[model samples]
Structures are given as C-alpha cells and as structure tokens.
Target: MKLVVEVKLLPTPLQAEALEATLCACNTAASWVSGVAFDRRTYRNFSLREHTYAEVKTRWGLGAQAAQHVIKKTCDAYATLRANLTAGRLGGPGSKRHRLASGKPIEFRAAAAQPYDDRMLSWQLDARTVSIWTTRGRLKGLAYTGGREQLATLARYRRGESDLVHRDGAWFLLATCEVPEAQPNSKPVDFLGVDLGVVNIATTSDGHVMAGRRLNRSRARDHELRAKLQRKGTKSARRRAQRRRRKEARRTRDINHKIAKHIVAEAERTGRGIGLENLTGIRERVRLRKPQRAMVHGWAFAQLGVFIAYKARRAGVPVVYVDPAYTSCTCSRCGYVDKANRVSQARFVCRSCGFVDHADRNGSRNVRARAQAFWRSGAPSTAPAALTGLDADGTPQPAVCRNASASRQ
Candidate 1:
C-alpha cells in the first residue's frame, strides 16, 4: 500500500526567510482572489474562475511559482469553507457578511510548495543526511525508504488517500492503498464488540473497558482553570488559559491515540472480527451545559474510529459498524428494552431476565451479536479477535473459547 512519510524540513535562515516571504505572498494573493469572488457574487449576474496562476503571478508581482502557490493556497481555503457549508458543519451564506463588509482580513495558513517533478519527488541521501528541493527552497531532513515504509512513517498516510485542507493549523494528507481482498475460508469464529461512551471511551464485547479517566480529569481541570482565568480578567490569565486549553487538547488527543492503538492491537491478537456502534449524530444527542459543551466540542471520536479502522485494515482485520439503535437500553440476554434497566451509571440489570452485568459489557455483547449477524450474512468479516481477557491482577487472560461459525470459514 502507498503511504506518506513526512520529515521535518530544516532550512538555513536565508531559506526560511525566503519561504516565509513566499507564504506571505501566497496569502495576499488568496485574499485578493476571495475579494474578487465576493465582489462578483455581490454585484454581477455570474461569477468566473478567471483567476489563474499565471494571471495571479503577473498581476501580483510575485515569482511564477510563488504566485501559483499563493493561488493554490487560497483555493484550498475556499474549498474547505465551501465543504463545511455543504456538509452543514459551518455557518451558511451571509452568516459572515458583517465580517466581510467590514473588510476584516480573511486569514489563510502557510502553504507548502508543491514538488515540480513527478518522479516520486526525488530525494538524495548520504550517510545520515537527506534533502529534497522545490522551486522555493531546499528541504533537508532524514531520509527514509522511498516506498511504503517512508510514506507510512512520515505522513501517516496510505496510498490513494486524497489531500484535503482545513482552517486549522494542521495539514492533512490522505492516501488509499490496495490490499488483497479478504476471503474467509472458514466459518466465522468469534466477534468482539465495541461500545464508545462518555465515561468509558470504549467497552469491548469481552468485558474489557478502556475508561476515559485522563480525558475526564483533564477536562475537569481545564474547566476549573478556565473559570479562574475568566474571573481574573488579566492579560496573563488569558494567556495562561490559552496554554491550559492547548495542553488539555494535547492530552486528550494523546489519550485517544493510546486507547485506539491498544484496542486495535488487542483485536489483531485474536482471530475474531470487531463490531462497533455506528455513532452518527451522537454528538447532537448528548446535551451539556455551555462549559461542558466547549470542552467536548472536538472530542475526535470520528478521527479515533478512522484510526482504528485503518489500523485494523493494515493488520488484515475487519471492523464492522453496527447500528447503535438500542445497544445501551436493550438487555443483551433477553433483548428487553426499558430505561429502568440501567439502574445507575455503571450497572445494567435486565428486568425481564434479571441479567446483571456491567453496563459497558452489556453494550459490547450487543455489538458482538450484531457483528456476528453481519458476518453470517456473508458480509466482509476480516477483523481479528482480540487477545484474551485479564486476570484478577489485570494480567493477560487466556482465550476461553474458540469456535468457528458456519459463515466465518
């Protein structure tokens, strides 16, 4: 599979300045293009895609490549905003009309110059040194294998992934790679169910819970600090608040990454497929106060899921997303549905069957059942089973059962 490898570019001071200047020029060009589009949409009957790299270069007095870079950056931003609007993820048209009319500057992030040649973007290496160059400047860094290894390590991207830009400071590169299509030769063996919740980030069908302890604590502290900072209303306090906000975000992301990695690794160790809840529209369903809302606004559950999916694919495992419908409320044993079934935050007692189990475990059992159903229907059943459970001291638990189903084989 194709992958992207990103190495930090180390340029000389002069080169850095030149690169910065090029980025500034590109930003200016993008602003101008946005202004043109705005004016046309405001007054004219039609808007045109008449802004070309060559034309921008000539009009803006920037070098040919640099001007083109700027225009591309601007177009990228427009595309991002457009996408958000189309996806109903951002404000609609005229929502930012006041800002536009006030001549407030439209901001754009720095753009990297594209490689001029198409031959896998040539790189030279000597000893421990590596370097590549674009029209703007040379990118000097460590060299990695030019193929999958390099791509995967540097870019964390696979082959065929598309590139998309966002308003955030981070850059995204997506790649899709091909693997031999999965062909199950035996009946289905076992299924591991996954349930994601606010308290416990994930509960597995095997009765294991990856609790969201760090996230909860981090969020709580962040809220407390934010309150104190707002009360102070000092410049230093505001700066400290921003620092704390960033730290909390980083901590949350780190925790999520670790949890996802552990989950995928465990699943790969077993020879069973994974079943997960399809949590679409979950964010909208969860109601919270403003402070809590802000803390959870970008929790990245989707990103975490994506990470798990891709990792599973690489390990030749399958991930199935089942409808979440009543996984939480329905009793896994008797399929009873009642609000009173969940007596507390951590307990699930079925009224019909009198089945008692950890709430997360019950959800996971339902997830596994759903996954097994999908597998029996001749759907793609590729994810491996998780490693066995844990001992009383939390050590690795041995596999207790292994039975291939009629469909899995």
Candidate 2:
C-alpha cells in the first residue's frame, strides 16, 4: 500500500524565500498554461506541453524538470476538473455550481503545492536535511523533522514524487512511500462489527462506544471562533481563522489515527475480521435541521473508515462492509424491526421480544450478523478484496462459533 509521510522543513530564511518564489513562479506559469489549454481545447499533458513548455521555462526561469512539472500540474488540474464533472460531484449539468465549474478555465493558487521528482529533491536521513531545487538555485542543507515512525518509514519505503507545500507560514514535504502489506488472514473465528455514528464516533459489536461529545464540543467551539473571525472581515482575522481550522483538522486526524490503530491491534490480537457499516451517500440521503447539518457536514466518517481499512490491511486483518440500512432500528436479539425500537439516541428497546440494549451496540451487533451471513453466503463487498483485505477464496472458517459474544471485549 502507498502512504504519504509528511515532514516539516526547517529552512533558513534565505531558503524559505527561494522556495516561496519558486512556488509562486510555478503556479503563475501553470495558470497561464491553463488559459492557453482552454483556448486551444488541449488538455493532454504531452500535447499541452508542446504549446507551453518553452515559454514556461523562459518566462518562469524554470529548469527542464521544473518546467515539465509545471505543465504537467496544469494538465492534472484540468483532468481533475473533468473527472469531477463526470462524477456529478459539482451537481447536475444544469445546476449553477456545475455550470460555473465547467465554464471557467482552471486556476492555480500562488501557494499551491508543487511536485518534486527525485532529480529535484534529495533526502539525507542521517543528517535530517533535504536538498531541493528552487527558482533561485538548488538549495541544500534544509533541515527537516517528523515523528520517529514517519522518519523511519520515509527512509525505508519513500518513493516517487514529493509535494512541496507552503501552508500557514510553514514549509512541508509530503513524500509517498510504498509499504508492504502483511499476508492476508484467510481464517477467522468471527467478525468485529463497527458501527459509525455522530454521537458515538464508533461502536463495536463488542459493546464498546467511542463517544464524540468532547470532540464535538471542541469542534463546535472551533466553528464558533471561525464564524466570529469571519464576521470581523479583517485580514488578520481571516488568517487566524485559517490557522484554527488547520488546528481542528489536525486534532481530528490524530484522534482517528489512534482509534484506527487500537481497533486494528485488537482485531489482530484476537484473530478476527472487521465489519464496517457502508455509509456511502449518507449526506445526500439524510435530512437534518440547520444546527444538525453543521455537525453532520463536519463529521469525517469516511476518513475514519479509510483509516480503519488501511490499518486493517497492514495487520493482515480482513474487513467487510455490511449494509447499514435499518441496522440502527433493528432488534439484534429477536430479529424484529421497528422505528420505535430505538427509544432514544442511546437506548434500544425491542418491542417484539422486550430486549433492551444500547442503540449503537445493537446496531453494531446487527452489522456483525449481516457480515457473518455475507461471508458464509458468498456476498461480495463493493470494495475490492485487495482494499478490504479479503482474498478470492475467502478466509477459512472454524468448525463452530467459539465465542458467541466475542465483540464485547
């Protein structure tokens, strides 16, 4: 699997100035190339390069590699826009959002990240420094820092292009690394069902609930601060808002990483597969009040799911996506389904059998049941086996269920 390892650069003042200039020059040239491409209706990298290559090099003072990267970046931006239009991410063709996106030529921000090939960037792990190409010259001995694990991963598996990013007055490099995956576990006792929710970030069929109240409160505070800053309508206020936004995002990402790591570790330790709810198109399918919408929209459910999947893959743990419809309201103990079964956000009462349990826990149990059935009945998940950590022949099953309430742990 390919992962990105980010390292913060500690560049000298002069080096920072050079990098800033380089980024500005590259993006400026890319914007010009985009306009040219729009005029000629040419978007292919090589074809577009034919029209802008020489000019980009001369005008931006870019070397051969930098010039090529600039043109390629411009082409990529247009390609992404085309993909968004095709995917209906911008809405219907007749919608104003879609029309506005399709009508204008793509533009690149002055501070947009620039990709650096190996020729343009070199890393020294022992010295903790990087030598990189810049508009001023090839700048060397730019110190960098990262977590120990990230640094180790970068040294061992780093490959391909690294993106040079300038954000919030700091310089960083996002290096791609190709990490090897563990052998897939074909045999499993049972599946660990994970139910994702707004109130509870994740509830395992094992009856573990990761409540989101504290995180939600922190996010609410951040949102309020941003709104207040925006209302000020000043440059400094906007800058502060941007920094706060980044801080909130980092906090969420760190929490998700920890949660995913713990879940994967537990599954690996107990030799069980993971079952996750399929919550695709949830935002479009669900309706909420204005206040609820902000919380829902800000929730990073998909990111959490992705983290679980990749971490699971690395641990040789199989993951399955179960149908989420009615899982929340269905009775896990008696197989009864009713809207009223969910007495409140946190409680579930099955009317048929008079069973009671935590709502999210019950939902997770349903997820586990569906996953077990799907595995036995040979129902393929929407995601490919490579991504979900399953195999073509499926994992070998035990003779019988050993732990009936295994998810509780």
Candidate 3:
C-alpha cells in the first residue's frame, strides 16, 4: 500500500557536492557492514542480521533517521544478491550479481541525519548547499523544511507507482505513502486470462491481444552504431556507445511499463481477476540461438508480471499465475493435446478436435482454467499452480493444455 513520491530538490552547487560526499560515505559504510557480514558467515557459523537505525547511527556517526534510510537501502541490496545467488542467477563470485558492479570497490556517499521526529531525515542538498549550511550562506532556491504540505503529498501514493529515489546527482525528498483500498459493493463474476509470450507480449482469454512491437529497428540501429564504434576503437566512441546503451535500455523499459499498465487497467475495469502463466522456470526450459537468447533475457518478463500483480492488488482485483504447461499446444475447445496442434509461431490448430485459435489465445485460456481450478481448491492467492505442463524429465508436454480460457464474448 505504500507509495513513494520523488520531488526534485533545489540546492546550490556547493550543497550538491556536499550531498554527494555524504552519499558516498553512507554507501561505503554499508559496503563495509555487508563485508563484515559476509566474512562472519564465511569464517564463523553466523547468519547475517541487518543493522538497525540506532546501531548504524551510533557506529557510523549518522543521525537516527538517516542511519535507518541507509540501512534499508543496504539491506535491499543484500537481499538482491542473496536471491540471485540462491537462484543461480548470479555469475560466480567474481561476476556481476544483480546491481553490484563486480570488481568495483564499494564506496559511501553523503551522510543522512535523522530529524527530531521519526518522519524525516536531513542531508546536504548538494556540495554548494553543504557549504552554505556550514558557512551560513544563502542561495536562490525554494526553501521549505519537511512540513505538513510535504506530508499531504506523501499520502497520495498508490500501489504500482514508481518509487521516488534520491540519487547523488540530484537532491530530492521522497516518502512512500499509502492509498486507500477500494471496495466494490457488488461481487465480481468475470475474469480475464492473460498469457505472456516472447513474440506477442500478451494475449487475453477474452481474445484481446497486445502484440509485441518489434524493437528490432532500434536494436539494428544500435548494432550499426556499436559496430562503427568498435571499428573506430576510440575513447569517444566508447563513451557514445555507453550513452546509446543507456538510452536503449530506457526506451525498452518504457515500452514494457506502458504495456503492463494498459493490461492491468483493462483487467481492473472489468472487475475481474487476471490469470497469467507461472513462468518461474521458463528461461531454463527454452532453447534459443545466442542472439535470441539475449533478446529474450532482456525482455523483463518478471518485471511485467510484478507490475500487473501490484497494480491489481491496489485496484482491489486479483492476479493468478497458473501452470504454464501445455498452454500453447492444448486445444481450448476440447482440451486436446498434440505436438502438431501448433501450426506456427502465431497460430494454434488443434489436431485432435480441429480447434483453431491464436497461439497466445490458447495459452491465455489455459491460464484462466488454472486460475479457476486454484480458486475452486481454495488455494491461497500467492500459491503457485499445482500441475505444471512439464513431465518427469522437466520437458513440457506438447499438447497438454494447462491454462483455462474465458469465453471471448
């Protein structure tokens, strides 16, 4: 229910520098703490325990609230690393795991000081701002301490909203606030089935399809630029390549976010739960060429699902992930399964009952069916599907349909 709102901070040049320094210090302290935990776990039979706000304040010379903020951020990073390691998603110890840059030394940034009240923390807006505060100088920018107006704005946060993050480059005040839950007086009767695919993005059980737009044009453009840069082998070209990489990443993320938001909105409007494919082990099961593998990996399927779930939760709707087995091959009409059921990448023609449907549509139907089954069994909202399409060997059955479909009408 908590939502984070980020607003730009206006501070002088000196303040910015000071803020950056403070952040660096905090990051360094956090890294040292994490290293200590890692060492303890390695040499001593001890588990990691996150340092509390008070502990950090006392040890690191930070204010109580400021220490808490740094601790939270550090714990979040640690959790990311831990998950990656457990999932085998991280490359070996020397490789980049999640966001931690491998081989780069961990450093801290600006420091945070907790306010007298538990609600806020104070940090230098910038180096210039820091200088001003230290020397009692003045600057031309809006000056307002954390107060009632800020608190009011913080209360508007809704689920699925982007978090307000404070970066070293800029100063901002951000807080995660909660939105009221909506209550529909009437009971819900309808449901929407959503199937996520590599090629098509999403297909609803109701026959609504959101085709994946080929970002290949953008990819191709980037490739040409990269190749030219590689041939030039100049420092400027390398810099340009880095900028291009960042831009492309931003564009791709924007597209995915838009698609996810649209899908969630549609489901919410219909007052129905969204049924989706449980894609837990999808990446491991599919075989692809090198280029294709990279593309698929970069699709951020997990983020899309997460967006749908959080958005649905906020809207008082539900999201259900069903087993992804046989979603593509099983006939939505008669539940017939066969390898030959899929006529092509985009088409599904059931061999057993001659049922013809879109490949994604069939998958969506299967997803809905699985959701209904779960609901009937009184499974928890967070429970995974009971029966996946994979057999004993972890190979998916060709024609075994897994997801259920709602009538398009």
TM-scores, each model vs. reference: 0.71, 0.92, 0.69
lDDT tens per residue, model 3, 42-89: 212122334344555566666545555455555555554565566566
Candidate 1 lDDT tens digits, 264-351 = 7777677776787767677789788886686466566654665566455556566777888888878999899998999887999999
**Which pairs of residues clash in candidate 2, taking residues 3 or more apart in a chain or in different chains?**
186-395, 186-396, 206-407, 206-408
Could you tell me the TM-score of candidate 2? Answer: 0.92
For all candidates in order, the CA lDDT equals 0.57, 0.83, 0.56
The positional error of residue 385 in candidate 3, measured at the CA in angstroms, is: 14
73: Cα error in model 3, Å? 5.0
Question: What is the RMSD of candidate 1?
Answer: 10.5
| Count of clashing residue pairs in every prediction | 32, 4, 39
Candidate 2: Cα lDDT at 35: 95
How far in Å is the alpha carbon of 323 misplaced in model 3?
A: 0.6
State the weakest 10-residue window (summed lDDT) of model 1: 400-409
Regions of candidate 3 where Cα sits further than 4 Å from its true position: 29-83, 91-174, 184-187, 223-239, 383-409
Q: Model 1 scores what on Cα lDDT?
A: 0.57
